[model samples]
Target: MAAPGCFMEHIAFLEASDDPAATTVWKEHITDDESEGRTA
Candidate 1:
């Protein structure tokens, strides 16, 4: 498992990236978690 800080950094990097693929990936990640009743 990734450390919490590293996971947060990855999320920050995804948010800062302008690439559409990155945005899609971020959206999918959030959606999956939300569906599982998890909060970001």
Candidate 2:
């Protein structure tokens, strides 16, 4: 199981992220940004 604090951190990481290239790179493993696509 994951910790509550870790879950919140993950949410923040996803919310604050703005780099498409980086998002795409990270998406290679996690699909959170799949629908959004590149944000420029």
C-alpha lDDT (0 to 100) for residue 5 of candidate 1 = 35
What are the TM-scores, per candidate, against the unseen true structure?
Answer: 0.22, 0.18
Per-residue C-alpha lDDT of model 2 across residues 1-40, encoded as one tens digit per residue: 3433343224323455676566644433433343336434
lDDT of 1 by residue, 1-40 (tens): 4443344325444356677684664333554456456766
After superposition, which runs of candidate 1 have C-alpha atoms over 4 Å from their true positions?
1-30
Whose TM-score is greatest here? 1
Q: What's the number of clashes in each of the models?
A: 0, 0
lDDT of 2 at 25: 40
| Candidate 2 TM-score to native | 0.18
Whole-model alpha-carbon lDDT for candidate 2: 0.43
